[model samples]
Target: MSKALSKRFGEESMDRIITWLEMQKISKDVALLDIGTGNGVFLIELAKSGFTNLTGIDNSSTAVELAKAIAEKEEVMSLKLQVADFLHPFPKLSQYDICIDKGTFDAISLSPDHPAEKRSLYQQSLHSVLKEGGMFLITSCNWTKEELVNHFSEGFEMLQELPTPKFQFGGKIGNSVTALVFRRK
Candidate 1:
């Protein structure tokens, strides 16, 4: 059986993003990203939809390698998984057409104190990767959509705020979970 994640990080959140991806006329050539990409499961789904320009980045080496293995075993060609820390300096900007951050900002926001750094890192990392006029989807529960917009909207414009995503608990399968969505403008 596959492992499970907490209710906050469950499939409901992914399904929300998939809806956004579907709304996009995802072609075989547009770049797609899954930042804080744990195991690259989200990228796998996007790849399944014929988005060939899929790239995934994670902070853990083991996770990156494991995601690569899983992608290989599944024969997925629309992916390039990497081990990268968003806290550090990043490369050139205007790279990808769309950036999907499943929960990277949420994890950073969960840290004790340091809202300034949390917001800054979110902006810089996102800035360095996304192309002008590209789409960025930030999924989180650590902050409400309004909070996320207020804190990180200095560089990014507010495009759209989708409804909150919900899921069942990992331990208690009957309970439900909710998460917010922010789209980059």
Candidate 2:
């Protein structure tokens, strides 16, 4: 599964995230939330890296169940996996020190059911769940860095833009993915 994830989302992406966490001196026990955690591979990797307090939430119940099963098979007992929509506030969950989104924002942006409204709700819900001054690391394929910064400008300030693979197309240089780290205001 890890190998498959590495193939789907380059292994370097996960390495970069772990590296950034270490460079920022984020504690292993800090409350961390993985938004739209598909199969929980990322959380499992974090667990392997020694992050103890981790929670992963996905909108799909089946995804949550798969994550739970994978975590169990991997002997990762510390992960808390649940099915919850990121467009809504999670009343039962505590505010997290860090939140990571790989493709949730992009998916919401592409939804045909009131995309603009859903995007707004996503921001509100994310703000509610993430602590002030907390970190949000997001990786997106649909939006450029500037677009992402603009979308999150309301309550998040750009901290750093992580490196991703680039290509030349139509006499222009573009990145296949944009990974940005933002700090909640």
Candidate 3:
């Protein structure tokens, strides 16, 4: 997962997304969850930026262990790393102010298995752990702006669309990766 993530999302892509998140002025008191947070890279960055309440969950046990090690080495005292699957039910008390997914959605969508059912459950799980009006930030290379917005229309309101600046063949505007925020309603 870590290697795949690194290959899919470059430093520049992460920098842009982080910059946009910083612009949101998220309060330190608010809970933040990073779904599929492999190695806690984004959580470490958030910790460095003074966000104290952070949680990262990944389905892979190895990824969770790596994230824990990274968090400890970086002295991210407030981060809680867990091994959990988004397709299953989360605890009732697990509510968050914000939830982020960098590439998990794309992976689920591209998998050969029951992608639609798993995707639906994943969205529901996100909503279950997110407070009303809480934000869900997703960065995906598999979905376009319209596809994502439409896909999330059932339970979330599209808040914003952020596109990566990579220029494809003929100087076209859009890139493989697209970033978007949706507010739970």
- Please tell me which predicted candidate would have the highest lDDT against the true structure: 2
Q: Comparing 1 and 3 by TM-score, which wins?
A: 3
Ranking by TM-score: 2, 3, 1
**Whole-model lDDT per candidate:** 0.71, 0.90, 0.82
Q: Assess the local accuracy of residue 19 in candidate 2 as a C-alpha lDDT between 0 and 100.
A: 88
Model 3 lDDT per residue over 1-185, tens place:
47765665756556766787778766866788888888888888888877888888889999999988888888787788888887785683267989888888888888899999888988888879889999999988788889999888988999988767565677666666788989999
lDDT of 2 by residue, 1-185 (tens): 25674476646667779889988888999999999998998899999999999999999999999999999999999999999988876686658999998888888999989999999998898899999999999988789999999999999999999988899999999998899999999
lDDT, residue 103, model 1 = 67
TM-score of 2: 0.94
Clashing pairs for predicted structure model 3, backbone only: none
**lDDT, model 2:** 0.90
What is the Cα-based TM-score of model 3?
A: 0.90
Ten residues in a row with the worst lDDT in model 2?
1-10
RMSD for all candidates, in order, please. 4.9, 2.4, 2.4
Residue pairs clashing in model 1 are none
